[model samples]
Target: MNKKLSPAALTIATVVIGTLGLASVPAAATRPGRAAAVHVAAHFDLASGQTPENGVLEPDGSLDVTFSVARQVARVDPDGGTHILATMPLPADGGANTPILHFAPTMGIVRADDGTLYFLYATGTADLTGVWRLRPRQTPERIAALPADGLPNGMALDRRTGKLYIADSVLGTVWTVPVTGGTPTAWTSAPELAYSAIAGANGLKIHNNALWVSDTDDGTILRIPLLPGNRPGQLQVRATGLTSVDDFTFTGRGDEILAALNHPNTIVRIRPDGHRTTVLNAADGLQNPTSIEVRGTTVYVLNAAYVTAEDPNVLVAGLRDLR
Candidate 1:
């Protein structure tokens, strides 16, 4: 489940943000043989106070982002023009004293080849929390509901099978929901999938015919083989000792992975042989980055900037050929 800050904690956070400002380390000097080049594609103005969490790349080169605080989705074009795509509904049970900040429609989003969008969001009520589908020129439709305590965070799609995989940080479980709106079933359950102190089983992807998941609280990445019927086999640890791994994407090389280490404010490249390298760090101007998407040779990152609550930006970089 998402951790709620106490009044005292919120006050402390505000104090810290006020004191530190939004200072970030400068990008490292480029080297002749480096495998990647990092730079900010767009900087979100703090005046807007948009706290974006996750995003997916559209075929037209625009990026669709989810704003957790604003409870809306917007499309950021290649040139940084943001157009609102949809505004999520407010929770039905929002009471007079309820903090609107606590309602996060969904932290995870995915797009199908047909341009349909799917997300996992919560409305602070059992009836409003679940997987939802949003097609162009249509209203958002609820596809499936999670358990009362389930908080959906990361998602993965099996394109070939039209099955969507949802990761619930609160319950530490993954569910398989049909793309066409049907019942969702538990696809896997293990100690590794359960939340520890904070979050677990975040950021999922279908790569090389297997399921790759990030165990955020445990600081590890796990791989589960996909069987003939889209069933998951035993879980295997792929990488470990990561720092607050949230969402990740496969690089051009099928064996390598790029992940957002949220707490450390860095992006890491996990090699096929299990070694890891910091591709981009705070010096590259990343702040609480939550999701990563690589389209062609361009890599896009969503910086949530949750700590300082300032300058939340979408960063872009170029990936050197890994082949």
Candidate 2:
């Protein structure tokens, strides 16, 4: 979901989603001293509504991705081949009631060690809006129901606790539910997570015994400690001035992270001290980059092209800093 603009403005912007445009790599993207050689690992068919919104990378180098507009989940291999895993049915109302996007879209995904996939689906209807699970070879099923009035954008699974945390972009709420699927609980609702004009609480990750959330509207990242008995501690602002950050992942090097700035078409490395560095940008074939996944020194970025309406692709690059 490339959502830097308000719901009203984004709806108007979709009028141009069908128009394609050529992109020129910025001079900074290819300037001297930039060490990463970013390349497209997979290219999606935008015409088929294949906008890769978010994904999780598997150990075998395969990417499990959600096709936002098509309401489908797919596995993209290293060789650029795609295999459809599951497809959510179209809502009867054509998704007109969907909170922000106004279209039933699938977002956020996490893969379990057992090859089970858990993802979010929001259709503005109680019947289909919630957390869904796909087992190895079974049909996708809704295990937990979320508020249809909210938009679940990003999620993280805490394997140690058997819990899943979901971020609601519209209601500005963080929800927690069991991995086995049941009713969801409103884990927290702080002011920093409230949406201003656009959205808040856009991305989420469980790292270092804490839950880190990104507020797209406020351009800030917050950390909430996971206390004993799963209680949430005081909120702490970790980083600021990060507008348009949709989803992020920790670099596994302390508190450092790589975040996707959707509107800017850039990905940045944010240090624990609030320092930021532009890691990749338009020159690196980014078209509204949405989410990031890091495995060792390799970084995978998913481009939704929701704003650019151009090439929706998955870009892979080596992070020299991580090396």
Candidate 3:
């Protein structure tokens, strides 16, 4: 689940933005590696709880998104059509027992090649808090139960290894579960992943035989190598000073990253050497940007508007010279 920014986080965001020296500039203005054009691809109903938290791009150009507060998973078509796939049931106690955020939230979501969709749901109860599986034409079911006190924030599926990696923000631990669904094991619990004030490990992705995670409270990106026998090697810090980063994606280049700085309301490209460049900002229709997806020369950004509480939408931008 996403969190409201505290005073300390706001202070850090100011420092980070000032350090980048990129403010609300014109969308067409040229920067080192900024997007050439940005436009709203879809607008969601914030009042109705259609805020997009995380998303996955479908092969046919559809976007599968999890509506966090709505506790629903829906697909947004290229033509701006929304089709509800599954809606998680409301908790019996009306989510009073929900961990951290105090409401049942459907967070990260990923689609398998076989057309099955897997997502994370945290309701602060043993029975309802866990990873969920939604097969085509079938109702959603809980496949793995996570700790009730922990909030599973981000998730990634390793196609090569058939394993799913989950980031428990409250617990500050990374868990590994088989795609077929069973017991979830604690893959790694590091100090770097623990929360200092806000959320801990917020976003996760597997790239180049390594697992990449974002620490929301720490404002850093971490990398863990996938060793032989599906074991984790060492944890390494990839980038820092990225305040309020939620989810990120690689630019198809070696190790360059485009991350969503949620509270900062900007998208930055972090290089392998830790140098950062602001690519998109509030001028590009960003409202608490949560996650991003890149395909070919286009970038899809999700703006949840959780804090802004206005104009929740998805922005599409052109990667002018990112190649």
Candidate 4:
């Protein structure tokens, strides 16, 4: 479940934002935030704890997340404590467990207007499959599924058209699927996972009339316009200095984009005008953040520590304490 700020906490946050606003009366300030400490509300797949994957911050501040433990998916609070939702048991001998266990725990998640949650999880273990939906506040039911080929790793939903943009890691393609549950059509293909290839197609979000994706293998932020006609056209590289850019998000006014890179384990802020600045290091902001979701002034990141046997995801928050 998502954590709700108490009335007192909300009041305090508002005051903090007000104070920060005073120092920003300047013309155009483009600096990443200071090294702020993030509170870890949930720890998934911790050695001794539960396993979780993609997560979303409910509009009301509750958590709607996924836990890929076996063929079943689990939903819990930010603290990984309360059980808010869960999926029906997976079919017996559904498929190979090795691949599914190796590649995906769960790749991405996007919420719909009616509070429905959509996600991309492993088909057996290694397959990067299609989109699946669960009605909000109810036990998860299979609404739809995408292709199991090419390893579909990242996903984003356009609220305007109800279309989903999916990035495939192996085949180097990004496709779009209709929310009404139909066949997904290809959008674009690339050459180099870095300069053009679509390696590690990890995270994605739709904002500012484009679909933003994190290509970790190539360490770049890719964006394609979302004009009319539902076709993804004109791909552009937004940011390029990071070693391994994973998940990213847009700030308020859709002015700034935030990204977390691997290797050095850092977070960077990319200005709308194409400027780059450091936000935080591994010590301060995150470990290995995989995806991000935003709701107004708050930014929620899933710092998925993927090395150890247990896959733990840390939630780093940035609350716009605007005065």
Candidate 5:
């Protein structure tokens, strides 16, 4: 959830941005030898204040994004046009305060094979906070309600089982609910998943027969072995030293992972051998990049530009030849 910026939070964020010198340098400057062929698939002007947090690439190649500040979900066409899909309705009692920041509405989103979209959003009310589904030409329907303290974020689906996995940034817990609609149960929880001062479990992915999750505050990516019967086995650290990691996806090779590291404003490729490579950075025109999705050999990055008060853009880079 993108919390409403309070005076103190704004001041702190400003200090952090200034300390990093991020406010002074433009995003277009390329780091020598680190440049990848990048293009702006879509650009959202600052006037719109559309802080796109997370998104999924659709079957037809369009990208669907969650505008945190705008409280709406929109589809970004292949040519970069944006079409609003749904505006979240406010809760009857005025949604409950978000866990920490109390910022914006939608957080995590995923699309099923049949064009059904499932998203996790803040309703400002405990009872209303949960997963909601939207099928084409159909009204939005609430499917599950998480605990009052749950601040749900990244999501993944097990296509074979028809189960959806959700990550709670605040409580450091992962919950699973059937796509057909049912109660959500805690799939797993640990000290590593809980939020410290910043955030906890942010992005989730099921790859290579295991569940991979990034612990933002702890700067670690954990791989939990998925056993039979939808049970989770041991939790092992796959990679570390990733500060403020957000959404991530498996590369075409399947042996490596691409992640959006928000704080340092870079996208990194983590190999199974624990080697990390900088694929793109602030120099490559990334601004507080929040999530990443790959279609074939093309990589799409959503830049929230959260630190800067202006001009957030989406960047697309081709990796077919590079790979």
Candidate 6:
């Protein structure tokens, strides 16, 4: 933890976790090829931290990153602003006593295409749900089971065919594990399932080979067709009247799918022929917008707000959409 922000912990985290600001638009108030008026840099760093789990570009974009602090994972220092290098602990994997590192954390801070840095954890605390791997430090590797009620949201690892797409969100199911290292297979979303399926299945990206899913209670954004014994059974419902499809990114230019449309705060871009665009609305200044990370033109939104004592949603990363 980066510590040093005590104003009573910054007024109990700005009156109980609330940090949402980023509605830039003034590179000169646009006009020329349009894309400027979006001004975002007004001080709300709130110590710069929260549940942002996936943002990379260390190859040399100068920085440009974003990640969860833990309980999933966190990292983002991509130059421009938001600086939070690293903070990890907890995540012993299905063995339990999690101590609580990265539970239900899909794509929990990835970097695998062989560059290897894939660290995901799943241990719903007790019942039994584990999928762990932390190689940079060398002592945490448990990839298996992970079905204690299963709420593991969005995980991806198809570096062409390494296969590891998990998104069980309370059983709507979509599991696949085959880093070539053993067993851990369960992919069910077939015949019929996913009707107001509750549980909150955030996001999962696997473009091309197709695996994109987001069913935060059917706000829609699904597509499953990953063969090999198959069974991820037919779920093709791409984009609907989304009002709660929080977190999605391909805006890296693979073409279309920007989605970070939480509640009212927006950031939808979806395309691939279906075409849809909003860029950013909620009048521009997002509030509950949680988790989003695009590198190119810069789009990092994580407007958070959750407060509860004995264990609640607990996400406190305000916003920062610089697009």
lDDT of each: 0.75, 0.83, 0.84, 0.57, 0.79, 0.50
TM-scores of the candidates in the order shown: 0.86, 0.90, 0.89, 0.74, 0.89, 0.30
Model 5 spans > 4 angstroms off: 1-27, 30-36, 92-96, 320-323
Which candidate tops TM-score? 2
By TM-score, the better pick of 1 and 6 is: 1
Q: Model 2 Cα displacement at 235 (Å)?
A: 0.5
C-alpha RMSD between model 6 and the true structure: 17.4
Find the 10 residues in a row with the least total lDDT in model 4.
Answer: 22-31
lDDT measured at residue 210 in model 3 versus the true structure, 0 to 100: 96
Error of 3 at 85 (Å): 0.8
Residue runs of model 3 more than 4 Å from their true location after superposition:
1-36, 321-323
At residue 118, candidate 2 shows an lDDT of: 97
Ranking by TM-score: 2, 5, 3, 1, 4, 6
**Once model 6 is optimally superposed onto the true structure by TM-score, how far is the C-alpha of residue 181 displaced, in angstroms?**
12
Clash list (residue pairs), candidate 1: 1-170, 105-121
RMSD of 1: 5.4
lDDT of 4: 0.57
Please give, for residues 245-307, the per-residue lDDT of candidate 2 as tens digits.
Answer: 788888878999899987778899998898999878887788788899988888899987776
Give candidate 4 regions above 4 Å deviation: 1-37, 48-52, 68-84, 87-104, 124-128, 192-198, 308-313, 319-323
Residue-level error in angstroms, candidate 3, position 24: 14
Writing each residue's lDDT as its tens digit, candidate 3 over 183-239 gives: 999999999999766689999999988999999888999999999988898999999
lDDT of 4 by residue, 1-323 (tens): 22343332233234323432421111211235533535556655443223334567766676665544322345545455646464434333443332313323355677788888877655543223467777755655444455554556667888877888877666677778877776778777655332233245667778778877777667778777876777666788877766657677777756578776643446677887778776555545354455566676666666544322223455555645321
**Model 1 Cα shift for residue 82 (angstroms):** 0.8
Tens-place lDDT per residue, model 1, 1-323, is 12344332243245334443534333333435532466677776443435567798898999888775566677899998888777777666541122222444456888999888888775556676788888976777888887756667888889989999988776788899889977889999768977765577888898987988998878888999989987888899999988778898988787699989876778889997789988787767776788999988888989876664445788888877322
